[model samples]
Target chain A: MEIKENKKDAVLLLELKGRLDASTSPKFQKKILSVIEGGEKNLVIDFSDLDYISSAGLRVLLLGAKKLQSVDGKIVLACLADHVKEVFDIAGFSVIFPFYDATEDAIKSFE
Target chain B: MHPSELIETNLYREKERTLFYGFIWSAVFLLPKTVAVVLSNSVVLLADLLKSISKCIASLASWLSIRRVAKGKDFSYNFGYGKLENLTSLVLAGVLIISLLVIGYEVYHRFLHPEHIHDFGVWFGLLIVAAKFVIDVYFWHHDRHLAKIDNSPIMVSHWKFYRADAIANGVVILSLIISVVFKNISGIKYVDPIGSIIIAGFLLSSAYGIVSKSLYDLLDGTLEESLQLVILRELAAFFDDYKEFHGIRSRRSGSHLFIDIFLEFDNEKKMGEIYQTIEKIRRRIEKSIPGSNVTITPTRIPFV
Candidate 1:
């Protein structure tokens, strides 16, 4: 998994791609943990190109969200592919992490 | 994180099933031989059969121990069940030693009574020893292959058991050969019991080694000094900016290593860069420590 980070308007935009299973989830977790510990405050995860995710992947997201919340920051998932979106919905993660259709909307919400 | 808490992976279910099959085969080979010896009322054959029966039980225990040891860390076991594997090794060693002692005592009784054994009893004992030798060799090779690929202590112990079985069988064959060579010698009948005593001594020493080592690990003794120095040096070398360290602790269960260290860095380092440094160090430490769980903590200390 590759995390491409961009900063604009005091919000961090992270592009995520590839399958997030047990083998790859740790890398994703480390990336997200680094982002949270870096004090980015607002995190916008763009999942437009992500293909699949397992329950372990979901645990990483939850772990990241908890870390972000500890610092009074918010984690938003944007551009969820339909299948990824379904997984989030099924897991009730959509209720825990606010989702947006585009990175621009998530950034605007942060503002 | 506690050492056991970091154990996230385990052997697959297929491996567990294979161990079960191996244990069953071992028992199958021992039962008929044991029954034959008891029916014939031959002390030599009876004692050998009893030893095989104990080996069968220890084999079953080995299977159970592997299953239990491969389990992930639970709330009751903060560091995982790796120690269970060590305990199993000790249990196996203890069982082998106890069997040897019992057989030794029986052999001593036979030495006092001096009874003549039938030719069929001798032939049956020889056949069983030959069969057991072949099986033990097969198991040893299989266990060695698995241990090479997986680095499992349980597999290593199993391999050692096979080696020990081969030695015991060789003793049996040697004693039989001696009886044939000295058929006219009046005092030659005591060779089998004397061989039993020697084999018992061999088992006692090996058991002491296994039990002592496992007990030390169960008590959380420091790992090999060289391994500790190598890990510490690897961390320092991988992260050049890390000037000092403290709270370095490590313990090993089976082949897996659990390492905890507090890495000192310059106080003014940005948290992001610091985290990146720590991440890199964690990766390097893991690479250096095979099958390792590494936790690196960033701490600020004066440059010295």
Candidate 2:
């Protein structure tokens, strides 16, 4: 799995490409938390290119969302591929996380 | 590829194919029919023209709804754009109603002051009827096949519209034949306008169908009783997992189902056990109702 990070106007955009499974979830969790630790509050994860995600990936997302909630910060998702969206739907993450169809839309929400 | 992925791919391809065909029919076939209407000044031709126009508008609305559904949920519209399909249906119904009023008015005027239709063009009318018959048959088969696979309301609606239009065209043809056969019969002049009224009536009924269904969806109507029963039966299997469960709400948005389960777990159970039980119940519900988003909330207070 590959992760791309960009900072735009204090919003940290993390774009994930490739499979997100048990093998790669820890790294994903570490990268996201590091950003949060670095004092970034508004986060948008782009999953337009992500092909697959397992329960491990979902755990990391829930942890990140929960952590952000504690600090009055927010994390939203954007451009999730159909398969990944289905997983989110099946796991009921849709109720917990806010999702946008575009990264720009997600960023706009923070404003 | 997974079966779900394969099905998604098929649906995408079919949508594109159907939209392309619609565009071809609108530009090539409908434009000529509009010209024929201008030439004939016949009530039956006007009804045929209006039917084609409604079909074109309906096709465009269906495509827009499909695109909106793909866009998914955003921060502003957290529940997703599934309702856009219903909204489109509502708007289409309104348009059909307006068209029906206009056609009804014209029919009424013609009944009071019957005018001879100049350049009736029986051959042209026959050609259009034949063409419409072919198009209707093709779309009926195509839409029905896709509807069976996808179970989309929009697809079913399209098939219904096409079937209705074909029958309307047959009525128009019969009216034209009556005018041609009984040219000397004064009563025969009413046939064309009467045919227009009949077509308007069909449109009115279809518009009513669309309006009622869309309104029901907009109001967040619950899923069909049979589907809700399936979910309830699945939840019954996990009776021992939770002390009590209530407020099991379920609604549908397009093809997606949203379920909220409120349960009072046994206080003696550990956190992990409670989580596992919730997950089990959710999975069971989802297994019974595919594409269901199940949210289980643990309530501290048990319902009386």
Candidate 3:
């Protein structure tokens, strides 16, 4: 999977492309950890272009959420494809994360 | 021992009792099934006989392993004898494979020499198998309940084990009914062998589930994906207590969950206060993940 990063003021918006599966989750994890460690608290992950996400992908989201929550910040998701949203709901991740209809909404929610 | 410890120990004892009784039950049913096979040329009964034999060995091994663990066989080991249950399950998977092979042979052999399955023993074995089915249903439900309470791998394995047996028993009963009642119908000779092949298919599926699951846990793999998320969620909820998240290590031993987390706390905090924080985190994680033993360490160094 490819992660395109763009910062909007204090919010860190990441546009995910391709698939987030077992093979790609490790890189995603490292990126999340480093960004969170860099003191960037607000995380906006846009899943519009991402086609698939397995359980491995969910684990990384959790780790990122944990770090962000510890700092009184949050990770919000946006533009999730129908199937990817179904995956989140089925995995019981919908309650743990805040989802938005657009990237602007996700970043604005942090503001 | 403490009351909670005593309760946990009793749960394990109950687990052992369930498996021991199941072993005896499987052993007792073996004879009539075998006799039924010998009394008739029905390949389905032969396949069931093989399944009964396999169930006997599997349950016996399962019981023995739990018995060993309960009897303090883990004094020499650090993590205890929990993985022994997984090892035993892997062995039982092998037994299922053997049963499948025997069924394959019987099915192949019968296809070559078509024989009518209606005889004095064909209808006779039906009663024994029907009784066995009822008993299997009981154990199947019972094992699930026990496994949920104790989270023992043997109970989980036997639950699936009995489910497969019960389902195959259902198939065998149906095949026998067709064999006896439809014996006058032309081309009825193939039904008995077809039933044998179907039993082999169930055995194959059960073996795959057992072998894959047992091998993964026996190798000290991490917690499953959902469970891993559960830990992170708990940690996230208690995020403010610790200064830094160093690392987390977790694995499954049979049905037991072992999780260790490393965190950095402020050095200025009193020892008692830091311990209270750790205890709270540990308690929450353990509560979220049932049958888990969680340890939180205060350290700057990352530990996996």
Candidate 4:
């Protein structure tokens, strides 16, 4: 998991490159939480390079979204491949969350 | 000690510590044992060489177990990965027991047909004793510190094995001394094999004890006596406002606790009060059990 902060738009880009299964989800959560703590209100989780996600990964993402919401912060998913999107839909996460096709669109909507 | 602190802990740190220690010990004991066996044609040296290999395997297993145990909770394993530690402990025990049996069989064969041992066996046995003594003492001191601060029972069990290894090496030195001192005492050469079988039997028992306790914890066995009492006291105090409390059920998973209670509150009371009561009980349990992850289910008492 690679996390990069872009100060230009106050956007924190998280690049998840590998499988986020039960073994690795906690680490993913910790990294995201740190970004949240740094006052990055606009979070762009780039899944373009991500391969797989288990339920544990989904739960961590949900927790992240909930935390950001409490602070009036916005979290958006960018570049969702078809299979990954299916997981979100099956879990009814699609109803609870806002998603976008590209990073530019999610960032623009945040403004 | 603090829930917030536990929540913030990096599950990777302690795991790395376990792996580092296991790897260090494996390299230290295994390298010399293998080299000694080749340099000196000694049966006792060969036996100790086998023991070193077994120790290395146990250490490797401990490393893998540490990684698994450190994982946090998820939908796949709702309770968390703590029980993975217990599973690993059981597996380690099984492996040790199997090694002990194989070693014990060889010892029995050696005893049945006694033979002369190489002179180099004496020098190698002495060096092993010196090395084991230093390592054993170091492990003992560090293990006490780790045991006090960490909740890792498996690590402590491994430390215990190290202590036993030191003792076995001491016995090896004794047998070597007796064999070298007097020609008539060559009869005592049988002691080495006899002692190994005895040591193997002891290792089997210790491993069995560790495996059983780990399995018990994994199965949601009873809590420590003092902790159980504290839970019951808190429950009784929380529900005192109700008419009576019955059928209080509780089970423990790693650090998480789940409790269910049947309450006979006044049927005349408002629903809001019942909700408040349940909420209060939930908070109380959480407070009582430090680092507790709790879920409480309330059942209304049936009217007669």
Output the better candidate (1/2) by lDDT. 2
lDDT of 4: 0.65
- In candidate 3, list every pair of residues with a backbone clash: none
DockQ of each: 0.01, 0.01, 0.25, 0.01
Top candidate, metric lDDT: 3
lDDT of 3 by residue, B1-304 (tens): 9998798789878888888888898889888887888887788999898888888888888888887887875459757588888999999999999888878977888889898875788888999999999999999999999888877778888898889889999999999988888789998999999988889998999899988888888888878777876776676677567766767778887677999888877778898999999998899888888999998888877553
Question: Which ranges of candidate 4 are over 4 A from the true structure?
Answer: A1-111, B1-12, B37-48, B69-73, B182-186, B224-226, B236-243, B248-294, B301-304
Top TM-score hit: 3
Per residue, candidate 2 scores C-alpha lDDT tens digits across A39-93 of 9899999998898887657757755664576578878999988877877766656
lDDT of 2 by residue, B75-136 (tens): 78756476776777787787788788779878888989997665456657767777877887
TM-score, model 3 to reference: 0.89
Task: Give the Å shift of residue B304 in candidate 1.
Answer: 19
Provide candidate 2's TM-score on chain A: 0.96
Task: Name the weakest run of 10 consecutive residues (lDDT summed) in model 2 chain B.
Answer: B231-240
Best by DockQ: 3
Using TM-score as the yardstick, the better of models 1 and 3 is 3
Q: Each candidate: what lDDT?
A: 0.70, 0.75, 0.85, 0.65
TM-score, chain B only, every model? 0.84, 0.86, 0.96, 0.77
Compute the interface RMSD for candidate 1.
Answer: 17.4
Can you tell me the CAPRI class of model 3? acceptable
- Each prediction's RMSD over C-alphas, in Å, is 17.6, 18.5, 3.0, 18.8
